[model samples]
Target: MDSDELSEKQNRGVAARIREELARRRVSRQYLADLAKISLSTLEKALSGHRPFTLATTIRLEEALAMRLRVSETLDNVAAISNGHADEQFGAYSRASVAWIEGLYLTVRPSFGDRQAIFAYCTEIHWNEAASNLRFNEKDRLDAAFTQQGTVSIPNLSGHIYLSTNTSGQQRLIIVSRPSITGEMYGILTTLQAGRGAQLTPVAAPIVLIPMKALADAPLGRINPDQPGFDAYAAYLKRTVEEPFAMFLPGVAAP
Candidate 1:
């Protein structure tokens, strides 16, 4: 069908869902109309299938009625199925099970050069595979496995350990060690500058990945993981439209 027809049908569906939710919650139609800043008559017509909707109007309805419309798949599928453009998926897609670490965080060490390190101060920890198992004299020790390869290209990783590439092609991994809040903003902001329409999101608790091109756009600064608001980077990730994936690791917990 035509775009207008599809949009009209979707609007009707949205209106119906909103009315159903309001009725289920015992909220009056007039109350909803007032909260939505729309006239009761307009609300009635939309709900009764007599009026079309604009994108802004639909968002308003959601805000006023507190109802979420299942439109992502509908829109995504329509574009792909109708236009033969299968690469138009929006939002985050999970490729592999994302792993999480509680106390560990990500920070970019640009000065560290093409090599990134995963440091831990623990008394003892075992390696995943052929990697070395070494005891550290201090609280901070870099995972020599990641450094062995020198600037490994990874889709996702945990605490100085790099994982396989993102077969899903929806994400790219970035490693950052001991970054400040402002430093993170700089990183993401720099990435945004390079990425433009691209977005950012955190797969693990502290590790954030963006389109590889965004790296040039990210700002520079030292980040401290021990301070408050360090996790704010995750919130920033959630604000964007990108695929987010995480895997469960041995010592890490999912947030």
Candidate 2:
């Protein structure tokens, strides 16, 4: 097939897959448009077959859906259709390694009851390019047995990031999200503790967000726990913030 025909076929496949995925996941057009960084009208047109997806648009879609729309596997040779000549716009992709996702995030998860949030210093991130998945570890656990290890899988049925751990015969699942405008990674924390319930369902609560380092050697100092995880946060806060974290603990009243 000619290059034009190949491109058109790929575009159609992309549109179809997008429609299928949206329908299966019951995702809103506006939500996807916002996540894909595209206008609602443009996303509607592309999904409805009124317009083909541009390379940039396709990249955004891939990131949002965690699925590839094109079978080329490499964006190196994708040139503009004009004059059937290679374009310089895609020359940057020839070097590869552009699709890698890696970073460290100071995460927080909810503690049981009404206790304050647990601040996890996420310092290690492992992203496997070939496997298309990632894992991270948080080392700020006050107790050695309570350390957290996280894994981020490719999106399929859900768009949420989940961090799970199985230790001491207990299972915990923390549904997380990407960084916010304020650079905080916040989400819901849930656990499957049979002692807490009889239905085998997960109990969930909103987590806390404490950025480890917002500035160079500057402190985010967001962890102000009340009872449960306050000790660990105070330990972290003492070294990270300008003020002592003891002031934020149970007896100390952070104001």
Candidate 3:
């Protein structure tokens, strides 16, 4: 495809994703533009995918909205379509289902609990029986661990991570937007109450594999957890986590 066609396709995909996210949050275009610190026209272009969001633009939006912002390079390449891996392309048609499911999770799941939301990750993308009955007190455990050890650094960035949940009561939903390489920065929930862990199930959203150690650093103040530094994290993903993961936990598979 020509440059115009490629840009058009990417723009359409990004626009769809942004619109869905905005609708989920019930925010308007002008509000988003203001938060992103961009002119309305610029915001429109970025959403349209004619302009891939620069690191600064994304950071501004994340802070203004107080929501997670992420970009998966594995999912960003527009060439994937012409290369015939259309399923992996960055377009509305390619990600429609995943975005819809994620939108649902973002909107519907928040009402289920009041615990501090934490986004946790596993070495593998899929869950195994060993972790099936596992009760994770995401923030509580991570906080305690951090207090004692300083901070944990996660090494992976694009393979798999998860939210904390329970059976009787739901803890906060840890939404892992991106993985940290040397810091503990993550999108965190406001409050964390003692609650039950959600049973492991099919992930409704795209999973970004992250290293466990990086997560430790962000919460412990070793790095700036703000959205502006996300590109640094993304850089980690491109260099490290996109491929060459360690051994898989037994019985785990990509869902």
Question: What TM-score against the true fold does each predicted structure earn?
Answer: 0.28, 0.37, 0.26
* Candidate 2 off by > 4 Å: 1-101, 110-120, 128-132, 166-170, 192-203, 208-211, 215-255
Ranking by TM-score: 2, 1, 3
* CA-lDDT, candidates in order: 0.35, 0.50, 0.35
- Candidate 3 Cα deviation (angstroms), residue 34: 1.4
* Residue-level lDDT for 195 in candidate 1: 21
Global lDDT of model 3: 0.35
Clashes of 2: 0
Best by lDDT: 2
Q: On a 0 to 1 TM-score scale, where does candidate 2 land against the true structure?
A: 0.37
TM-score, structure 3 vs. true: 0.26
Winning candidate number (TM-score): 2
Model 1 sits at a Cα RMSD from the real structure of: 19.0
Error of 2 at 90 (Å): 28
The residue-by-residue lDDT of candidate 2 on 56-88, one tens digit each, is 787777666544456553433233222232124
Better candidate by TM-score, 1 or 2: 2
